[model samples]
Each structure stands twice: as C-alpha cells, then as structure tokens.
Target: MSDLTKLNSPELSQFSHILSHAVKVPGLIFLSGQTPTDSSGKVVEGGIKEHTAQCINNLGKVLDAAGSSWEKVVKVNVYLDDMKNFSLMNEVYEKLLPSPKPARTCIQAAYLPNGVDPVIVLNHPGQIGAGYAPVLDCHTAHIACKFAELLEKIDRRTNKSIEANPKTIKSGDSCIVKVVPSKPMCVESYNDYPPLGRFAVRDMRQTVAVGIIKSVEKTDKSSGKVTKSAEKAAKKK
Candidate 1:
C-alpha cells in the first residue's frame, strides 16, 4: 500500500476543486499556500499583519485535519506581492509560528490573486476629440508600469465626489476615478510600494495618461462586496 493520504477541511470546501489542501505521507506532510481569505472565501479586512495571521489560521485548520500541527512543519514558503511589507508581515509571522521555526523562503511576486485599483492621472489637457476623453461607461486598459508587469482591462469606473461629478474626464483634469479590474491582480499603494504603484492608462493602442496609486479597495471574491479600503494623499503637481 502507498502510505499516502490527501487531507482536507470542511472550512475550505469552497476551494476543494482548486487543489488538495495538503498531502500526508508516512512521516511528512506538504501543504498548499494559504491565502488571507476566510472560510466563506472573502479576503480578510486589514493590512499585511492581519493577512499573515489569517493565512496561518487557515493552515492550522488543514494541519489539524491532517492530524498534524504547526510544530511539525519543517519548511515554509511565503510569496509576497511587495517586499516592502516584509517587516509588517514578519511581525505577525514571529508571533504565530512557534520558535525553532521551519526553514522558510520569501520572495516578491509580480502580482498576486486579488486585484488592483486604477487611478487615472491626466497630465495633458483633454482636447475636444483630439486628446483622450474617458467616459463613465467605457472600458479601458490599465497597464501596470514600473515593477509590476500586468495589463488589466477595466470594465468600468465610478467617479468620486470632486466639485461636480464629471461624466467624462478630459486629458488635463485632476480628479479621482475608481476602476475595477476585469481580472484579479496584485497591487500595492504608491506610498507603500512605489514599483507597483505607477501605471499608464491606455485606450486601445494609445496611451492616454499615467498616474500613481492613491488608494486600494478590495472586493469579496464570493459576494463581490467591497471589504477593504486604503487611501493615500495624491501628489500635487
């Protein structure tokens, strides 16, 4: 008989099809990377510190389901969207994982699973039909520049309360635009991770504008409700 068994937890049933939670052999067990999502599949609300805690909590569930414990964990691998969060993430890691911790490796990833926020910064003035004009319901491309190499197609955007709610943004206007990515992507605030912060606005093949991240709002993966929000001061020209 192959002394191998697959481990699972009822709390993680929603993610069962994605992959086995863990695998156990005679003397060792291998676990998949646990995200900061809850049992209901919603990303927990908070910063990296809170996120790190949730990941470990989820891992504990799988560990218990496998008849194992964190004390037996021999190795660990952490993938971070931004290395700048290392210190904050480490603070939580040190508190949760026991001493004489498992061998671990941490690396910055170009992008993660959730999604990114797109804020447009208009540099030049919008010309009537000559320059770029973004309407309320039009889809546009949000190209991540700097460190993150991602091209996310935005389905639509909401206008923030600025003077009057403008339906169409001209090329040179200064205002806040809220956009949702067509797909999930990893992104960080410009203040927190500058490399993942800068991006270019594209309409078809033309680059319309460029901007830095002012805020981030993450939606629930299952319910699609806004769960977390982070804001930063927009730079003055």
Candidate 2:
C-alpha cells in the first residue's frame, strides 16, 4: 500500500460517497473543494457571499484537523462561476485569511455546482514537526448524487415547514447553526439566519456539528404544540 495517509472528518465522511475530504502523503496534503453545504450535504441557499463564507469555513475546519492553518498557505486557486462576484468574494476572502497572504489566482468558470460560485482551493504547508509532513492544500466542489437521499429528507421537511407557515417563509430562510446531537436537541440558534449562511464548529464534532445549518421546524401554528411525529414523518417521506 502507498504510504499515503488519509485525513477525514466525520462531517466530511458523511459525504464520503462523493469524495475524500483530504489525502495526505507525509510531505503534502490535498483537500477536496468545499461547497456551502450543511452536515447532511444540503446546498446553501444564500448568494455568493454566503457561499464563499461556507467554503472558507469548511476549508479551515479540514486544515485544523490536519494540523495546519491559513497562515501556512502558500497558494490559492479560486473558481468563480461569474466574474461579477469577483470583488464581493475577495472582500470576504481577504478578511478571513491571515497576513502575508498566499500567492493567488482567480478565474471564471462556465459553471459551478448547486448554482454556487467561487469555489476556493488552498495550498499550504502542512505541519512539519516531530515527524509530521510539512505541506498541505485543499480544493472543493458542490456535492450531488451521493446526497440524493439526504436531500430528499430535507426537502420533505422543508415542504412541511412551508405548509406550516407559508407567509413567514416563502423559501429556505432558516438554518440551525448549532446542534446538540447527543442530546437530541435542534433549534434555530440564530434569528433570521440567512439561507446558506456560514456557521462553524471548533474542535468538537462529537458534541456539536456545524456548517450551513438548516432544518424545517414543525410546530402547530395554532395550539403551538410541537409535532414530533410530523417532523419525523417529513424526514421519512
């Protein structure tokens, strides 16, 4: 077997049917392109700003997991579905990355997945201490196919949520930024959280999972009794 070591996160593994989050071979680490998606692989609904934030947040998570950080990045490749959003994406990108920014390139592509734009790839030097490799990098792409079933669940719940309050939500607008999975807890952690807005988790996927958190809330509009079965049925549908 090649001495290549694979780096993966439970969150990324949740989408393993599509791609490996990252692959490492001592001196180099390669990360897959990250799109704005939740833990269950739902495409984020916000515009390019949200998409860019989600992409960078996802990358940062993987880099931290692999013993590297943005400061170590030596190169960057940005792919945009349209050139018009170039300035907007850069505004967010520059603010998030550390000083002495890495060499960079930006290009407009004919298309990007999930109708999303500005997929970013970071190439950085990995941790080189005490026997670990010294170079790291990452790329991301929108997810599909592998996420069909999960998407179905989400869609069903979304339909149910809309049926509950058509006026309050015309489209996907709410997201669950924080989840206490073990406790079976889910809530709208952020008020009026934008669709596909970026959320993150640091150092604890076991206790918490974060991304573009989105979920359909099932509550009785009149009596206000939460419908547990309704939510479950929606997910099963």
Candidate 3:
C-alpha cells in the first residue's frame, strides 16, 4: 500500500534493510540485488546463462525471507545487461515458473547486482495475480519494469512514446516515471542515448530504471539456451 520497493540482499545485508516484521503486506524484495555466486560472498562466474541461474537461486533466498516464493510471484521484471543475452536469458527464465504464468516484462540493463537495486514484493501470490501489479511501492522496480515495457512498444513503432513526468525525476534527467496500462506517449529522439552501464547503478536509494535505445540483432554464437524454472511455472496449476 506504499511506494516502497526493497531489493533484498543478505550479502550486502547492511545496505538498506527492514525489521523482522510479519508479512502483513505485499511488497517487492531486492532493495539491492546482484549476480549469484554464494551465500558466503562470491558471485558465480559464467555467461548470461550461468549468472542468471545463480541469480535466480540467490533471489530464492531473498524471496523466502520475505515470505514469498517464485511460485507466488505474479510478475517477473528482468534486467539483462546485454541485448545479446536476451534470448539466452529468456530461455533460462521461461523454465523457472510453476504455472498459470504471471505477467512478465523484460528489459536490457547495463548491469544488475552491482550495488543491488532490484526489489521484490513480499505479498503472497493470492494477494495479487496475473494482469495486476503488486499492491506496494514497486515504483522503483515497477518503473524500470514499465520503462522496459514502454520501450518495447515504441521499438515496435507502435507510435506510442514515453511521456516524461516532472515529479518522477529523482535527479538529473531522471523523472518520477510511470507507465500507463495503455496510453499514448510522444516519442522523442536523443543524440546521447544513455549507456546500459548507467542504467543499473550500484547503490541507489530510489527505484531507478535507466532507459536504453538499441536494435535487436541476430548472432550465431552458441548460447546453449537453458531454463530451470519454466516447467515449474507451467505446472503450477
């Protein structure tokens, strides 16, 4: 019921935190998140596929503490650092769900887990279902989620561009951004497009979703797509 998104991270346990309060509310976790490596403080090494799998496992610990599991998850917002990793990343993700698929949104970020800024809602899945957003201040997480969604639409040349809001700006050109379920937004072109690296900041206080402009390209390099959660998502019924 508030605009607060916390990316849970036990490794950076001292970054931003909360009390051992009951789950009287639903919220996003990840006050800060990074690549998966170890509970003892070692980020696993590998390509997008390896890092992603470990990241999801690491997220499990965080979600569990928040009293929510990926099965209870209603939506998954992804931040891929490289566009080339998109397909491989999706292949990894599609396999993780448990069924009745939750609405999913994906975006490419320059980085994630650096300072840990991905948040998760702690509410039970029964509290929120597909097609609806979490009843929490996922503004930070949600904003990035929406920004990615909006960009997708625009990239499709659907004609709707992102409308800038003044209050949404936490600083600099960043605005207090929000995405409409379906609305008309004017698209504007810029010369200095923000780099993916700048998007996923390491230690940010606000729910910051950095926007990137790019064209999807095809490559023949073997990605070896893998998914450990997709079947779980499909069998949850």
Give the per-residue lDDT digits (tens) of candidate 1, residues 1-237.
Answer: 489887788886344433689988888888888888776555688999999999999999999999988898888999898899999999999999998899999998754544444344434344212122332111233323211111222222222334433344444344444444444555656545544555555544554555556567787789864332223111112
Error of 2 at 40 (Å): 1.8
Ranking by TM-score: 1, 2, 3
Give the range where candidate 3 is weakest over 10 consecutive residues by summed lDDT: 228-237
Estimate the TM-score for candidate 2.
0.48
Quickly count the clashes in candidate 3: 45
Better of 2 and 3 by TM-score: 2
Q: How many clashes in each candidate? A: 4, 9, 45
Q: What is the Å distance of residue 159 in model 1 from its true position?
A: 25
Query: What is the lDDT, from 0 to 100, of the residue 111 in candidate 1?
Result: 43
- What are the clashing pairs of model 2? 32-139, 33-139, 33-140, 33-141, 34-140, 126-134, 126-135, 126-136, 176-213
Model 3 lDDT tens row, 74-193 = 666777766887888878777865676668777865435442222221122232122322111211322211222211111112223244222222122221222222222222111121
TM-score-wise, the better of 1 and 3 is 1
CA RMSD of each candidate after superposition: 13.7, 16.3, 17.9
